[model samples]
Target: MEEERNTYLDELSGDGCRIGGYPIFVQYGPRENEELRTFDTLLLQLDCEYECDLMFGDGGIANFFINEEDLKKLDFTKVLYNWDCC
Candidate 1:
């Protein structure tokens, strides 16, 4: 028998990828600059050798940045990184 499970993917959406324990959602905009890019793509955009920083925000929801540096620093893998892309 298969038990039912409802994850963040199940809660928010079913279009993103999961890394460690965090649910990630991606949306590529129609405009050239607004489009979402891959690691290498963003690297080229910033022209940096180190890891880049990404943040997301909205109206009255507060702002937040997603950084693997913090994750690696704290050695945590279950914390949530909720970014509303709507």
Candidate 2:
């Protein structure tokens, strides 16, 4: 039981890929960039998944960010795409 609880916690702490959630960067955060800071919405995050044979150059994570206003307007022309690895 204790082991199971720990496993759950570990999963929650892990930075897995998701859509429309916070980004889990492998390196510097989005806050480091002024332009990225304005793009508050996380559109997509693709993390390295060995089980699914998906990778982005040595366990890199890909992220797409967009401004809340732009997202609400359904304008993806100015979305920012970034990726990083360990």
Candidate 3:
């Protein structure tokens, strides 16, 4: 029997909040276990304008915003590196 690949996002309240017009959900994955993962980082572009909020394990709340210029210069694959180096 194949073990079911568990997915997060099944535990958040139905009406938590909306980010960049997409509803935020609690997501769990190998990379991010038991955390909130937005549908698209693009939503971070909305920033404070939208109500999307991320609560880090350290209890840090980060409001993300990505403008056209920021997006153009962003390397999605190296997000962790950027975060670490910055």
Best by TM-score: 2
Q: What lDDT, from 0 to 1, does candidate 3 have?
A: 0.31
After superposition, the stretches of candidate 3 with alpha carbons farther than 4 Å from their true spots are: 1-61, 75-86
lDDT of each: 0.29, 0.85, 0.31
Angstrom error at residue 79, model 2: 0.8
Candidate 2 versus truth, CA RMSD in Å, comes to: 2.1
TM-score of 3: 0.20
lDDT of 1 by residue, 8-36 (tens): 43555533233333222344322223322
Clashes of 3: 3
Please give, for residues 1-86, the per-residue lDDT of candidate 2 as tens digits. 99998888768654778898778888887658775688888999898889999999898999999989999999999888899898
lDDT of 2 at 45: 88
Q: Please report how far candidate 1 places residue 70 from its true position, in Å.
A: 0.9
RMSD of each: 13.1, 2.1, 14.6
- Give lDDT tens digits, candidate 3, residues 1-86: 22332223333433332454333323322224333332234333111213444434332222333343445676443231101100
Clashing pairs in 3: 8-28, 9-26, 45-66
Q: Residue 78 of candidate 1: its Cα lDDT?
A: 32
Candidate 3: Cα lDDT at 56 = 45
Q: Cα lDDT for residue 38, model 1?
A: 17
Candidates' TM-scores?
Answer: 0.19, 0.82, 0.20
